[model samples]
Target: MKTKKMGIQKHYYLMMLPGMLWLLLFSIVPMFGIIMAFQDYNPGQGILHSEWIGLENFRYLFQLDDSKQVIVNTLIISIGKIILNLIVPLIFALLLNEVRSLRYKKFVQTVVFVPHFLSWVIMATIVIGIFGYNGVVNTIAGWFGGQPRLFMADPSIFRELLIGTDVWKEFGYNAVIFLAALTSVNPNLYEAAAIDGANRWQSMWHITLPELTPTIVLLGVLALGNILNAGFDQVYNLYNPLVYSTGDILDTWIYRLGLQNLQFSLATAAGLLKSAVSFILITVSYVLAYKFADYRIF
Candidate 1:
């Protein structure tokens, strides 16, 4: 019996071998390049021979004029998206779950999920057309005798645009998880609530919402890892010079520094800072998940 169990465990280990190897090769190995954060990295000299300047790059990063603005923009946009994304999806999932027609529910889910699969490049053009001076939005405004606003170019509105568009794009896919959580809720609980004179809203508030709390906490905590990630592709594709003041984020800043400005060392330092923050957030998230949600990811 012991030998049979050992053999079964060996098979399980074998099944995990490929994924483990891939993670080690792509994820763990590349982490060694974090050394560039502390060095004045030179391509010609390469990483090994690069001049070591411990914390200098980080110091320079903090001293930059736009650093504070960029961090503020990143946090505001990301947190707004995070909060909205969770709320929108959970509400959407609950509403969809209430629909009696399975076909209509699936159709709505499909329509919403379609946007998630669309690349940001494609969506950017669509957004531009809708928000442009001569576009649908402005044309509609003109009908109401309002001014044609430059949405993509306005610093004041750009962050909101980023957040709104991101939430619209991702909420459907996010709701899928919530929908799945809804399925795990026992039908008997609803029946019991209904027997006690609970309405739909009452049942949802008293039973369904409580049942979904663990799932919500788990997803919310996991999302904290992205606190510093303010959608690089979406923002990069949509933003221009006019909006950079309020829309520029850590990822975009890193891209400009490394690719455009050739300040590779500074960019790496910024990237390192982001990764460090994300790691801490994820760690805290895991701890919270365990404590509040009674969930363990690892």
Candidate 2:
């Protein structure tokens, strides 16, 4: 029996070999470049021969005005997404759960979920068209004698746009977990609540919400790990100089710094900082998930 079990496990390990190699080539190998953060990296000289300047890049990174603004923008956008993604999905799942017609429920779920599968490349174009100076929104506003606002270019509302669109795109996918959690809820609880003269809202409030609490807490805690990841693909595709004040995130700033401005050291420092913070947050989030939600990877 032990020999048979070992043979089965060997096949599983063999299956994982390709993924492990991919990770090594892409993720693990590129991590060696993190040393550039502490060096005046010269492409011609290569990483090994680059001039070492310990902590200078980090000090300069902290002193920059753009760094502070980008950090603030990232936090605001990510936090907004996290909060809305949690609440909106939970509410949507609850509302969908109450629907009597199975056909309507499945159709609504399918319609909302389609956006999640679409890449940000496609979504950003659609968003830009909708919010452009002469797009559908402005065309509609023109009829009401209102000025055509440049929604995409406006700095004041740019963050809101990013957050709102992200929530809209992801809430349907996020709600799936909530819907699955709802199924595990004892139907007898609802039956009992109905016998006690409870309405739909009352039953949901008393029974459904309580049953789904663990899932909600688990997802919310897990989301803390991504607090710094403010959707690079979405921001990179949608943002411009006009909206930089509000829309620029760490990833976008790093791209401009390194690739555009040729400030490799500074960009690497910024990236390293983000990676370190993300690692810490991810560790903390997993610990919290284990404690609060009884989640365990092993």
Candidate 3:
């Protein structure tokens, strides 16, 4: 029996070998480049022979006006997405639960969930077409005797547009968790509430919301880890120089610094700072999740 169990475990370990090797090649190997954050990285000299500069790159990063603006943009966009992603998905799940027609519910879910699978590359093009000067939005405005406006180029509303579009794109997919949580809610509670003269609103508020509190808390706490990750792919594809003031985020800024401007050391320093902060946030979020929601990986 022991020999048979050992054989089975060995097969499992073999299966895991490919993934472990991939991680080492891509993720673990790249971590060695973190040394560049403290050095004046030179391509000819490479990471090893580069002049070590300690915290100078960090000091320069903090002094940059562009860096300040980028940080502000990242926080604003990320926080907006987090808050709306939480509230909108929960509301969507609650409303969906009230849907009695199974076919209609499934249809609506399919329509919304489809966008989540679509890459940001595709979605950015669709979004540009919709918000373009000659697009549907401006065309509608022209009907109301309003002048056509370039919605995509307007810096004032850029952040709001990013948040709104992200919420629309993801709310349906995010709602799946809440919907799953809703299933575990006892139908007896709803029946009892209805018998005591509770309306749909009353039942949802008093019974459903309470039942889903732990899930809501758990997801919200976990989301704190991503507070710095303002959608790089989406923003990178969509934003232009005109919208840079309001739309540029840390990832895009770092990309431009390293690849575009050839400030490799500065970019690495910025990336290191982001990684360090993200690590701390992730640790704190996990602690909070464990304490408040009784959530744990192990």
Candidate 4:
């Protein structure tokens, strides 16, 4: 009987082998290139034969005048996106939950979710068309006697644009998880609250929100890991030299350094720093989630 059970489970183990191998080959193996971060990496000499200069690359990164600004931009944009992503989705989900009309709920959900499926490349064009100097936004402004402003070129508004567009793109997708959590909540709880003199708002505030707390905390923890990633594709597609002072994040800076300027080692070092910081953030977030919310992602 034991042998039969073991043989049955062996196929399950075999089913997981391909994915494990893929992760090893693609993810784990490439991490070995991190050694290039500490070296004066030469393509002709290759990684193994390249000259090692410990911490020099990191020193060079900080020496650049734009480096601090880039780091600040990344954090500001990412953190803003993270907060808005959670709040907008939660509010939308709560509002949608209140709608008794299933047809209307589904229609609204579908409309909002369509944006998430569109690639950033396509969405960037749409965003530019709407916010350009003579675009739809300026046209609307003109109707109200407002001046035409160069939104894309303005450093002051670039970060706001990044955050707003990212939130608009992803809020619906994020809300789906909250909506699912809403489904698991027992309807009887709502009924009980009503019998105890609770109104719809009171029921939602007391029963619905509390039930959604664990899921919120778990997703929040996961988001903390990406605090340094400020949507490279969107920024790259929409940004210009005029806005680079406020809009350039770590990834864009790295691209220009490594690809355009040929500072391979410096780029690698910057990337390695980003990964290390993200890992530490994720680990700390997981620990806090477990401690505070009794939520364990793993």
For model 2 the TM-score comes to 0.94
Q: What ranges in model 1 sit over 4 Å off?
A: 1-29
Off by over 4 Å in 4: 1-21, 290-298
Ranking by TM-score: 3, 2, 4, 1
The Cα error of candidate 3 at residue 287, in Å, is 2.2
* lDDT, residue 20, model 1: 95
- Candidates' lDDT values, in order? 0.92, 0.95, 0.95, 0.93
Q: Give residue 57's lDDT in candidate 3 (0 to 100).
A: 96
Tell me model 2's lDDT, rounded to 2 decimals.
0.95
| Residue 140 in model 4: lDDT | 99
lDDT score of model 1?
A: 0.92
Structure candidate 1, residue pairs in collision: none
Model 4 sits at a Cα RMSD from the real structure of 2.5
Which consecutive 10 residues in model 4 have the weakest lDDT in total? Answer: 289-298
Is candidate 1 or 2 superior in TM-score?
A: 2
**Candidate 2: how many backbone clashes?**
0
Count of clashing residue pairs in every prediction: 0, 0, 0, 0
Residue 171 displacement in candidate 4 (angstroms): 1.0
Across 1-298, the per-residue lDDT of candidate 4 in tens digits comes to 9999999899999999999999999999889989999999999999999999999999988999989999999999999999999999999999999999999998998899999999999999999999998899999999999999999899999999999999999999999999999999999999899889999999989999999998888888878988998989989998999999999999999999999999889998999999999899988988888888787756
Per-prediction TM-score to the true structure, in the order listed: 0.89, 0.94, 0.95, 0.90
